[model samples]
Target: MQESQSLLATARSKLEKSLLAKGLRRSGERFAILEEVYSRNDHFDAEELFQAMHQRSYPVSRATVYNTLDVLVDCGLVRRHHFGEEDNSKSRYEKSLGRQQHAHLVCTVCHRVKEFCDPRLHLIQTNVGNALQFEVESHSLVFYGQCTDDACETKPTDSSANTEDSRKTQE
Candidate 1:
């Protein structure tokens, strides 16, 4: 965890310098969003992050969070997950620095995400790209399972899925 913190701090510092080099104005709000993500121990979606920040008295808008997350994703600093085939709407995100090519185990009941890093999976990615002769840009692999929670086990089967609603954000 200490190493992760140090890596994140270094990455943030370099990112700030890069922005300055590109003649772009540094954004305190964007830095705040990135810092929150890098500091979190659990995977969180944008809406979850918004609620958490609001509760903590952080002046962070939902759009700002989303936009900042988009920047991080583009810059290869975060990983985004859209789990399951039935619901593409349930999206989540996490920091990807120092954690490369990991799969997710998302509980269908509680939605708790567990990270899995398999080298064999990494090999497959490389092999598939070679065999298909297509350059792989990116991929998302998530496995859905039941949680250990007893309450989760008792939930009705095939009921209306838990959905993330429109994030309240100031345009």
Candidate 2:
């Protein structure tokens, strides 16, 4: 918790500097959004962030949340990801403040994301970029499959049970 609070404070200071550099007036809504984003260590969507703020009576609009997210992403303070396919489509965002570049394992059925790192993968990325004569600024890699969590293992005894499990997973 102390580490996160430290990171959050650092993130806020950086955000203020970025806003100033971009010639944008600092706003409470932006700070509130930044606070929420910096507080969490997991990926979340705009609606999720907005809802969290609203639940805490932050008095921010959905549009503000979306727009602020765009600004954050533009300023390199956030990383946006489109992890799943059409039916399960959603754009998730995570703070870029104190994160190292890593890959993701996405559960297709449960939508659970796990981060992993491998030195070999980093070497491969560099080699591949060199072979293709392209400079690689960054990369997002996602491996998709069903999760091995216990909740995901239970076979549905009936259609209703399956629906309940699906709903829970989505939540």
Candidate 3:
């Protein structure tokens, strides 16, 4: 518990600095939202955060959560990810503060996201960018595959369905 609290405090301090640097005012709503985010150690969507706040009777608006999310992302306090679908179909946010750069392993069957770190991947990115004559600012590497879970193994794999899902995401 003490470690968690310490981490939260550190995150709050970083957020405070970022907000002040951007000339943004600090408020209870924004702090509460940030606290809620730190409470979770996994990826989550905006609706999930909104529901959690309302369930706790925090008295935050949907717009406030969304707008604060934008600010947090802009200030580099949070990281937004689109796991599979194009139009953020599985869009999620994860706290990036104090977290090292890593790649993701996404389970297509269960939509589970796993984080992994590898030096070779970083080197590959650098080599690819250098070869292509482009400076790589950052990268999001996601490998999609079925998990070893029974459900995932039993799930049907259909290419047409994936195509349809992609089309729907585009729309």
Strongest candidate by lDDT: 2
Q: What does candidate 2 score in Cα RMSD to the true structure? A: 6.0
Tens digit per residue, CA lDDT, model 3, 1-171: 897788789878887898899888899999999999988889888999999999999989889999898887887778999886545665699988777889888887777778899999889989999999999988888899977766565465678679889999999
Measured with C-alpha atoms, the lDDT of residue 35 in candidate 3 is 92
**Ranking of predictions according to TM-score:** 2, 3, 1
Query: Clash pairs of candidate 1?
Result: none
Question: What lDDT does each candidate get?
Answer: 0.75, 0.87, 0.86
lDDT of 2 by residue, 1-171 (tens): 898889888888888998999999799999999988987889899899999998888989999999999989988889999987565567899999778879999886667778999888889899999999999989989999877677764423468778999999999
Candidate 2 deviant stretches above 4 angstroms:
87-89, 153-171
Candidate 1 regions with alpha-carbon error over 4 angstroms: 17-24, 85-87, 134-138, 148-171
How are the candidates ranked when ordered by lDDT, highest leading?
2, 3, 1
RMSD vs true structure, all candidates? 9.0, 6.0, 6.1
Candidate 1: tens digits of C-alpha lDDT, residues 87-135? 6786678887776777788887666778888888878888999999989
Model 1: lowest-lDDT 10 consecutive positions: 162-171
Q: Tell me which of candidates 1 and 2 scores higher on TM-score.
A: 2
Residue 22 shift from truth in candidate 2, angstroms: 2.6
